[model samples]
Target: MKESHKDIWLKRKQLGRSRYLVLFGLLPWGLGLTVITSLIELISFQQINPVWVPARLVLFFFIGFFVANARWQAMENRFESDSQQRP
Candidate 1:
């Protein structure tokens, strides 16, 4: 089916919102993970291990996926509500 202009615009808006969420949200989350992981390693292992770098990358990827998904859902919900309100 051919898509309307409004639909195209909405999709672009949603994409932009998701990108914004993923890019901005990942920084603080990764930083917090690094700090907590470092603290744990320091207390338990008495030194920060090199393994943390890879582990952090994997964890950050998964967490970023979920966070972006959540933000997309929220944007979708808001878009639906706003569309419904339009005459």
Candidate 2:
């Protein structure tokens, strides 16, 4: 028998032991943007170029946190809907 969506979500939540998945997703995306900008600066050889590493870090944190919260919310919603649907 096929597993319910709720069961799948529960397993995904419980098995998501490491909190690093959020970082893994956020860092590559943010860092990719940062690196591209930084490279453009290097290629142009601009004096006193500003890449804003701090701002990139903030973006990374925000994205990571948002992703984590979204995952949790999705899981909770799935569980609640499943419970409501059950007889």
What TM-score goes with each of the models? 0.58, 0.51
Off by over 4 Å in 1: 1-15
User: Which is the leading candidate under lDDT?
Assistant: 1
Clashing pairs in 2: none
Worst 10 residues of 2 by lDDT: 17-26
Report how far residue 5 has shifted in candidate 2, in Å: 4.5
Report lDDT (Cα) of residue 3, candidate 1: 42
The Cα error of candidate 2 at residue 39, in Å, is 5.9
lDDT of each: 0.69, 0.63
